[model samples]
Target: MASIVFAPADLVVATSDDIKVRFAGADLAAELPAHVQAPPGAVGVRVMVSGVRGPETMQRDSGFESARLAWYQQRQDGGPAREGSAPTMPGMLVLERVGALLRDDVGTECPSVAGQVGGDGTEWKGSWTYLPHPPEAARTL
Candidate 1:
């Protein structure tokens, strides 16, 4: 019998025609399009997000240094529990994109960049970023 091994949940990422993501690895059946399939490849147009709580800190010395430092610390030391009353629900952004499938086996590990998506003070709406090497950059499907 062929043995099956599951990859780490966090290691499992999702790629579609519009947005490519490194999520907690959700059930793709519901998210997959009518004609899409498993082992999907990169799309020309790629997107990613970081910092789900409020907005992400921009790199450089301009500002938001403390917030960025805090996020980095949390990742290294494990997320610290907030002392005061935690806000109901976290800062989040919902992205919409097109879906396309890749024929070849793109490795499990995806390369991503941090980007900000909003101007709001309470949320960091940025994409985690995906880069398409082949046919390149696709619009929403």
Candidate 2:
């Protein structure tokens, strides 16, 4: 449950392979948590996004679907192309990363970050973080 808050200008971009990030230049890859499992699934990616979104803001109504769309659109347009929309908030997104399986011990307060693809298959839960360009920054995703 550790957390890190990055300045609005620090993150440069993110892609399917890795996130290109830094205080300014593209010199570093933002580190993922140790609990992260490989072969990351789409639903898990969404959880990490929620983590990056942090717990302070309103949970996106469409979950990460809408945010993902907006982010990709920003990248495709070469920069922030939206006109006069609500200002984007700046803060570290609080993504849920599971450390282990909770199984039948799941509790009422249990986070959605756990679970796995069982023999019959199951959906993974959680997301990662990214500093989406604030409206003022208007930079690429």
Candidate 3:
């Protein structure tokens, strides 16, 4: 199993087909050099996972292994610019599928996705556990 950590202020948007993690602006400012100019309303780094199947369940781990992963950098104009795709360099995302699991959370089983992704000296190894969404009433509270 792998572990992924996110700051409390990080924004994570997940759907059935994709997951996006946008770095916090304050974190970016601290990490980036003073000469680096971040566009307005855009984060410095964004990690995106797409083409994922069975993300809400563990019935299709094989398909998840083949999911597409990519990262983007914000342009000077607040748009995403794809990073590092030279012919000699490996692709931005290289999957090393470790497997998937269903975690027992107080008797409720939740989907857990674990894998190693990246290439050419950069890699992110982590597992993401997804809890079911709350009911409408719960959300309104």
Candidate 4:
């Protein structure tokens, strides 16, 4: 799997067409296609969380459901943006917590918090690494 690290400030923004993922210190943006099977050599996307601050309890709420809901909603709208006529594949969005990794195989459909004290405690700050799953053919090699 190939990995892309995202800093705390990096934004993973979702749009009507695609999810814009930014890599730290780089201008590269990975557009995760929606509602389609990945092409012959498409890679899947996974995220690993690190540098989390706060109690260990927060780890339990890995925010998988919320992510899945958002992904489903996005696809229901229209799906990710495409570059050309070439059909793009929808990659999985896996969220890896500190100890346990939650896998959300984002095929067709699939599925956080932290913040100030007394402020819902639903906000969390951390760095995440994006691991791209190798193409099916490559995995067997």
The TM-score values for the models, in the order shown, are 0.21, 0.21, 0.22, 0.18
Q: What is the lDDT of residue 88 in candidate 4?
A: 15
TM-score of candidate 3 on Cα atoms, chains taken together: 0.22
lDDT per residue (tens digit) for residues 25-94 in model 2: 2211333344654344322211221112223222432454466577768767767645434322222221
- Candidate 4 scores a C-alpha RMSD against the true structure in Å of 17.6
Query: In model 3, what are the clashing residue pairs, if there are any?
Result: none
Per-residue alpha-carbon lDDT of candidate 4 for residues 1-141, written as tens digits (9 for 90 to 100): 223444555444322123233222211123344443445544334333322233433332345445545666666676662222322112122112222232333422111111111112323322222234433333120
Flag regions of model 4 displaced more than 4 Å: 1-43, 54-122, 125-133, 139-141
Score candidate 4 by lDDT: 0.31
What's the lDDT of the predicted structure labeled candidate 2? Answer: 0.29
Q: Write the per-residue lDDT of candidate 3 for residues 1-141, one digit (tens) a residue.
A: 122334344443332223333322121111222343444432222123322323432333433333323222233334444343323211122223222333323344433222224443432222222333222233110
Residue 85's lDDT within candidate 3 is 33
Name the candidate, 2 or 3, with the larger TM-score value: 3
Report the CA-based lDDT of candidate 1 relative to the real structure: 0.32
lDDT score of residue 47 within candidate 1: 38
Highest-scoring model, lDDT: 1
lDDT of each: 0.32, 0.29, 0.29, 0.31
Record all residue pairs in model 4 with backbone atoms less than 3 Å apart, i.e. clashing.
Answer: 17-80, 17-81, 68-111, 113-122, 113-123, 114-122, 114-123, 114-124, 115-123
